[model samples]
Target: MTDRDAFVARLGGVFEHSPWVAERAYDRAAATGLTAGTVHSALCQAFRTALPREKMQVLRAHPDLAGKLAIAGKLTADSTAEQASAGLDRLTPEEHERFTALNDTYTKKFGFPFIIAVKGLTKGQILASFQSRIDNSPEEEFETACAQVEKIARLRLQSMIPGDENA
Candidate 1:
């Protein structure tokens, strides 16, 4: 594969079903050297400056945490692993029900899934965050979700590219 193609192939899913982030990032990275930091900055810049509609598309692209896609074994590989890391893959029935209800309510309220970067969180922590964020104003929640998406992308990039978290 060409360098750009390979770059996109590896980093594409950093933004949950949004390969375009990687593609656009690569266009920028081609001008600079592709290091973990440069790639991450480019990717986030692409995401951050996206149109509101595109940003919403990225948010909506995410699966509901521990919701139907996971139960049906349909989550992307990255999502599945990240959810499992947070113990979301092993929820008790009651917890599962709670997550399902929260997912529904959050989606209805915010027009997108409740997205937290689940890498270092526990199930209870995630649930607590979900419950609290549900009460946020729509504008507040939208910005919060976008920020979380950026965090998720950073973590994903760090895993593969191995460099500064701030980058």
Candidate 2:
């Protein structure tokens, strides 16, 4: 079969599980070429990391503070049914108010929600980074955002295997 066809077939397997996850890599694949073989190899080459560099790029591209659809856990109490995991979640009603204000300001300034992979971080940790990054120049934050997204994407890619891969 053609290389693009192989990549498409492979992508079909990966994306079937989570469109969000698949979108990240598939977009990269599409940009490189419609083929499965080249795109997969390109992704591995570009990402260059153990998991794949393209995956990281994909993860970093996500919009944080999603409506109720986040495949990831909630960083805030606003959309979650459970207590917010980040220390920001523990904010008093007043603190919560301020957190929202800051989040709003940050979002307005950046064009996307403040994103951080909350897997290993606590509220305090996320807050510290958030507060610090809030003052970051757009260029700096953009790179930082990309870096974080890359990490998240790598994690997701690792979660998917080649064959038993999701739909």
**Highest TM-score model number:** 1
Clashing pairs in 1: none
Q: Flag clash pairs in model 2.
A: 4-35, 4-36, 7-36, 16-167, 17-167, 47-53, 56-150, 60-149, 86-123, 87-123
TM-score against truth, every candidate: 0.94, 0.51
Report the Cα RMSD per candidate: 1.4, 8.7
Error of 1 at 115 (Å): 0.3
Model 2 clash count equals 10
lDDT values for all models: 0.91, 0.50
Model 1: worst 10 consecutive residues (lDDT sum): 158-167
Identify the leading candidate in terms of lDDT. Answer: 1
Encode model 2's per-residue lDDT on 45-139: one tens digit a residue.
44444243444444333434322233345332222422243443355666555556766888788765676755557666766777899999876
Mark the regions of model 1 whose C-alpha exceeds 4 Å error after superposition. Answer: 163-166
Instruction: Name the lDDT value of residue 80 in candidate 1.
Output: 93
| Residue 17 local lDDT, model 1 | 92
Overall local distance difference test of candidate 2: 0.50
